[model samples]
Target: MSKVRTCPACADGAAAGDSFCEGCGRTLPSDIRDASVENPDSVPTAPQVSLSGATPGPEHDGRPGLVPEDGPPTAPQVSLSGARTSGPDTLATQPMRRDSVPSASGGPSPSTETARSGGRTATSAPTVPAWPPPATGSVPVKPTNPDLCSWCPGRVRTGFCESCGRLQPRGRDHVEVCAPGAVGVSDRGLRHRRNEDALGVRVLPADAPHAPGAVVAVVCDGVSSSPRSDEASRVTAEAGVTVLAERVRRGEDPRRATGAAMTEAARAVAAIADSPGSAPACTFVSAVVRPDTGAVTVGWVGDSRAYWLSGGPSASASALLTRDDSWSEAMVQMGMLSREEAMRSANAHALVAWMGADSGQIDAHVSTVTPTGPGAVVLCTDGLWNYYPEAVDLAAAVPGAGAAPREAARRYVDLALGAGGKDNITVVVIPVPGGGGPRAGQA
Candidate 1:
């Protein structure tokens, strides 16, 4: 006989293989039954797609608009911005350039000026196209809703409604990327109408001349206060991931590749700026993971961070690997204040370094670690970390090491939402090779 399950929403009995509760028509808990048994071969699978959304892709299986059991949600119909549904798209080679440049940030100044934050002196400069720099090209993204006007049938353009002049959700209000060796999720959070955050992740195969298989994950958080911040973050992340993947595939050192990637990303972002005073800006962070060697190299410009979550007996203890280039962190580093006190100050989150046309001296910091055991690498924007700022606490909250990267990342996003997601949240989870069991010290 088939088993029965209780619906969490309506307290009604749901028969085996039922996906929706008959009583309330609500989605049944995923554990109710083996969905595959209902339709063994009808599962939705990701097809080749592109970031530009110019090519046609496969449609989702099952009911129209309904998300497949194991697949990410599909984009709503009538996407004005032409958002693509989440899928594993091909990563194309992009040109990259390398050069030394200055990076800096502080208060929003209408004109170029010198400022000191966290003891770093920087002067804003005009946007230029020449500074030599750097896509995991065309990873698909799924938006939360359509950009239709509520008052009329007209669609939303850019951000304003076409017929009623009202504001609507941006194309990237929500996004998910499930690559070969890593997975990432980005959401616009509760407090932000626009998702000023972006992500790019790719898994490179081992067929390259002299390099091992690797996974590249990049996250950028746009300076929300700046104009076109969303565009800045998106371009920066795309450039970083694309350039890093190419360099790694060419057998370049992870550190040098990371710095080179940052330079290119900075140029990409700077190109969007109208002037130094009104430049779009964002924070950048990346992780390059080589499973063969258990090597993880991290690179960063601002506060976005990478964390090592040791899961097995052989792995190193979970820890934060990158330092923030913020006023509060600088003060703490200089022995001017306690960590708690520095964080409490009003200017705590003021950025001392960032990527933009105006930022002076685009100095990228790189760190490397080779773990002996099993673990997972986490790359995230401040949105997720602002809630669980400590490494131990974050490691305790994540799923077991054996969990799939996509599901694990989904859990983190859900946690942030439950805790009142106040900022745009973006997170990527890349598992270290050879993890044989559950995550270590998981509470």
Candidate 2:
């Protein structure tokens, strides 16, 4: 006799032959009697199909005249129909018990028993979506102006304006001056754009007793053709002045110091060229003076000039040091034309050699001059020289005439601006020692 078993859904005890639970009206498996008789470890295996065989229905499982257990009883019965049905299509056609089906959330439940008589593996967990989306706020940038100058215009925006040819300013701090002596710059004309390019260093031994009789000065001109020319000029001026001053302190000859400084500047230019981004080139001209010996040494590249203005009231000023290397000078040197022809040529402004040329050797024009009493040393860029035709006129109008050297430098700059200052202007003046006569405490 078959034993009775409790129904899991209704908790009612039923005999092996019962097809429905008496307590909850739930349906029971027809094979319960056979299942109770078989060993608990042995499960019923699915029926296999052969290539040459008749189609079988779930009614074949010892229940005669009963509805097929695979799907709804009312559905049409078709043998091996390719069409999918909802129920048996999900269970019967699915892959057999090589692996257990995972629960809806993931992983098989603990109650699930392995179809085979061995241990079962835990199903893999489902992947979850990321929470809390990324932040959407973006950083805001300040707007810039469109019609400012490239050298010193504040906050330029549009590269160039159609109306006035002025470039737009990039940002509010585009024209900031951050170094010593940079703040001392004073723009002369209202129309003139103030730029660091026009700034330079003119070092003279302080009237202080400790560093007497030594003076060093530098003049740098920004290449108007390149962007950031102002920065290049400022850096070159400051670095060149500092290095030459240190050399002077070490008692090196001013001529040798000038050459060494140019060599250093050449290295700086090469470094700029080696950098990844855009770099602007510039021209450098410098002079150093030993007031005690009346000796002055000068070094220059490109058109920025140095001149020795001498001969008291009755004497005429001569250009002791002029633009040593330029297109016009090159034409004269190559004998392609006479010096007068080159001077009058329309291409006079062309530069043959400058401090930052990519190719061709840097031709540093180094010269030494010992002037007679009361002479002046003038170092300026083309901006000032372009306007002043005669050295006499420049000497006459130079700032602080008959005053100290520093004052004279300031006056010369002022005069250049007063003369319509179309381009960037710079000037440095050093009065020869023993000319105005030696200062107190000097030999």
Candidate 3:
């Protein structure tokens, strides 16, 4: 009769030729088990590797206080014939070493067996080590707004849908700002993932300086290639408006205040960069419309633009206020390329100047225009101009007299979105006094 084989730890029976105990998944010793004989103190077993990538002593059970006080436990001397073990614990509790990994052939390879039989041990360095069991505890759940994501039942966290793995719409994805004398709209165009454009508009109080009813507006377009460009544009718009309002309140010249606002905006954008390589960048355009004197001062960097649309029917004339700091414009100005040729070049839209830490010393182009008749001051990013491409086309699209500034601004944004919205769009509309629109403070 074949002798019965059994696991020493669990006292479970093992069939003939079986290497592991089925009861607890423990390594089975090759030696026979019989009540007539006492079990051996030490049995040859597979080498074990610790979490620290080191070979542990024979008595190392990973539990503290097991080591003798005198010195480290001595390793046992035994012959490796059939049995192999990963550690003192059964396979259910202990992670297997990489070298003794289970194979299609049903057991360790011949080479491994040879090494073991020769009293040699080996260890494997797996690319990823086993991790400890997760701590057991109750976790607090945070309350969430279920309606944040439309496509998935999962909650939206940090602008992303956790279940569907989709990007969630942000607050700035579409924004509208309405003030007493100006209205602005910004949107994440159809083709972009988020809105990188920002707008700020404010109408000076009735008791303020030279231009009491002056409207201050700033539009910034984040450079798509820069990291956190959206943040750069937002901070720039905010800082520009704050400084412009402060300077204008102090009775500063419209042109000088616009320039100072640009300078302050540049500093704010520059401070957003955490390092030289990741400097957030953007294009800036600001307009200050003084309805009292019919004076409009525009300042700009990069390709964002400002335009003055003369009041009247759709056929009314319009003028481009700020010059673009773009490669095409620079080429045309230097006579290096004709207007049509420059526009056709691949670098046509490349910015020659922008607001960022890397962009040194910004000299904002400032211009003042005093229109005799009523008109509207429009400030926007290229997203809107790329569709119209001309002052007259944009002027024709503006709502006629008596249209609320907010309505006009929304109309312009809708026009851009209807045109495929290949990029982020932003537009600020400030009706010049006598422009025939609703008076100041009208929503």
RMSD after CA superposition, every candidate: 23.1, 45.0, 33.2
Candidate 2: tens digits of C-alpha lDDT, residues 271-368? 55433223445677787666656555677766677665643532223333544345544555456766566555434444544554342343455665
Worst lDDT 10-window in candidate 1: 91-100
TM-score attained by model 3: 0.61
At residue 12, candidate 1 shows an lDDT of 58
Clashing residue pairs in all predictions, respectively, total: 15, 19, 1
Which candidate number has the best lDDT? Answer: 1
Cα lDDT for residue 38, candidate 3: 21
Worst 10 residues of 2 by lDDT: 99-108
Q: Per-residue lDDT tens digits of candidate 1, residues 332-376? A: 655676767765544456566678776655345666656444668
lDDT for position 136 in model 1: 16
Whole-model Cα lDDT of every candidate shown, in order: 0.59, 0.44, 0.57
- Give residue 191's error in model 1 in angstroms: 0.6
